[model samples]
Target: LGGGMTNAVLALAVISWPKYARLARSQALTVRQQPYIEAARLSGCSDTEIIFRHLLPSVLSPLLVMSALDLGTMLMELAGLSFLGLGAQPPAAEWGSMMSSSRSMLQTAPWVILAPGAAIFVTVSLFNLLGDSLRDQLDPKFNPK
Candidate 1:
């Protein structure tokens, strides 16, 4: 389970990095176009100085929201891998492990599988809802014109 969780997190970080970089770059580009950035540039601010001192703070909110959204996805992927026996070992009491063990008994005691499956479903859903809410609140694009 630990290994699976680690792998999932690492994979997500790697795969999602480009998007994050793009967001940062886009934000930086926008910030750079602002008058304050122009003033700082005219005052002889370096590129790194402009980015770290000026642009970073402007994009912090969306960056934080995106990070929170990523957490839920990483959890779901870890649970999925664990459910497939590629994750948690036996007797660990993880939701995925429980579902895996209950597969054969699915017809006999559907509750056993349903319970854990439902838990995972609800957790994932809640995280997704939270992420959507955060995005809506943090990003101007989602706002009604």
Candidate 2:
């Protein structure tokens, strides 16, 4: 179970990082054209120094928002995999496994399946809402008048 979660996180990080890196690079490229960046360069600052010190901070807000959104998605994927028995195995009382095992009883005792399923639904929804809120708050382009 632990290994599965770790692998999921690792995979998500690896897959998501390139997109964030591209956004960061685009932001950095734009920031680099700013007068301050030119001034820094004129003052003998290295490219690495300008990127880390100037450009990175400017793009952190959107990256953080995106990361929060990714977390909820990763959780859903993990739960789906676990439910299929490809993740957590026997003896573990994971929500997915519980839901999976209750599949046969779903017609008789629908609550058994509904309970865990609802929990997963609510948790994922809350995270997604929170991420969207964060994105709205952090993104200058979405600023209210």
Per-model TM against the reference: 0.76, 0.79
List where candidate 2 sits over 4 angstroms from the true fold.
Answer: 1-3, 43-49
Clash pairs, candidate 1, are none
Give the lDDT of residue 79 in candidate 2: 78
User: Quick one: best lDDT, which candidate?
Assistant: 2
lDDT of each: 0.78, 0.79
Instruction: Rate residue 66 of model 2 by lDDT.
Output: 78
> How many pairs collide in each candidate, listed in order?
0, 0
Deviation from native of the Cα of residue 12 in model 2, angstroms: 4.0
lDDT of 2 at 34: 88
- Report the number of backbone clashes for model 2: 0
Q: Which digits, one per residue and each the tens of the lDDT, describe model 1 over residues 7-82?
A: 6557666778898888888887787789999999999999899878988887886787877777777777767777
Off by over 4 Å in 1: 1-4, 43-49, 140-145
